[model samples]
Target: MSRFLFISCLCTLLLACQHSPKKNYFYLSPISEKTVTQTSSNVSSQLIGIGPVDIAEYLTSSQIIDNQSDNTLTMSDNAYWAEPLDKSIARVVSLNLTQLNNGRSFVNFPWRSDSKPHYSLRLHVDTLSRTGKNANINATWELIDNDAKKSILRRNFLRSIPAESGAKGLAYAYSQLLAELSKEMDEALNQNP
Candidate 1:
């Protein structure tokens, strides 16, 4: 009886130790409805291609990253991104642009060869990390006039937004920053077009 009880207790302990913590996944949200509605009337028949968003090496991980200090970085084990961060950024930016400029056609990268766009937007993220209280994004974007075969606009954008607390909050902050960037891009496109 003693031996059986000892084995059962050990098995239970082992099973408890093997249990893993629940993981949380997060994705960036699109622009708010108010902003979308206000700008939705801006119509354009041009097709814009958004793609080839390049990000930093550290941001390639599926885990959410936090900057503990200026140099120290920490990646969350329990919090994860639902999709690739670069792809998410591109998707959100594309969605926000669509909302801000209704009637304008936007397609992501790798569109059908025959369905070429008039403008191509490319983004490169140099920094996208969150500290304890804020999240920061530094990036450069270029808009190419595919028909003209020339670069029309090249600009760098940097924003620091206050984050709430956890990984979810950081994700929200990032989304806001992307929306702002999209608005700026829309303004630029209107001017150029």
Candidate 2:
């Protein structure tokens, strides 16, 4: 009994010492400053959705240490959150909309306008979680029609990255998320023509 307790205590101390906290920070970077280009199918006037939304912001929480694990991100630097992921998603969506057509853009939500749009696109995002096991991020994306006020498309993006604490994981996960989101958006929007 004594031997078992001593071994466990020693192991605990060793782990606590080995796992040093890092100065980590992450931000989702824009793919590029240039506007995304799409060939306009409709020549007529269109007023599209732009956003400063009332939707809930992105949320994040951390899990306590489970065991000693080292991954590429952590081995390189300390972990920390930077420039919330939710905001990045919003920006990406806005950018993509701008690229979709020669339509005017506005940041106001509830999607009302003096000039009516041919179609209105609104996105509601839920569950951008990063889990400790394999550092996976799971997100559900919904595209709604402002005129109809109902969902036209709902899709989930799930990605797994190496488990690294802090900003590294966030950045890696976000990049993956953006790629997935953009791809899906392109397909949906382009499907019209």
lDDT of each: 0.86, 0.52
TM-score per candidate = 0.87, 0.53
Candidate that scores best on TM-score? 1
Error of 1 at 26 (Å): 0.2
Give candidate 1's total backbone clashes. 0
Model 2 TM-score relative to the real fold: 0.53
**CA deviation > 4 Å runs, candidate 2:** 1-25, 33-47, 50-84, 96-120, 132-135, 161-166
Clashes of each: 0, 9
> Model 2: per-residue lDDT, tens digit, 1-193?
9999999999999999888785555555544546456555454434555333223342432222222234212222444445444455566666645555434353534444565554544445444444464544455655556667766776766666564455455565556566556667656765642
- TM-score, predicted candidate 1 vs. hidden true structure: 0.87
For model 1, residues 15-65, the per-residue Cα lDDT tens digits are: 998897888999998998775754543444668999779999988999899
Candidate 1 root-mean-square deviation in Å:
3.1
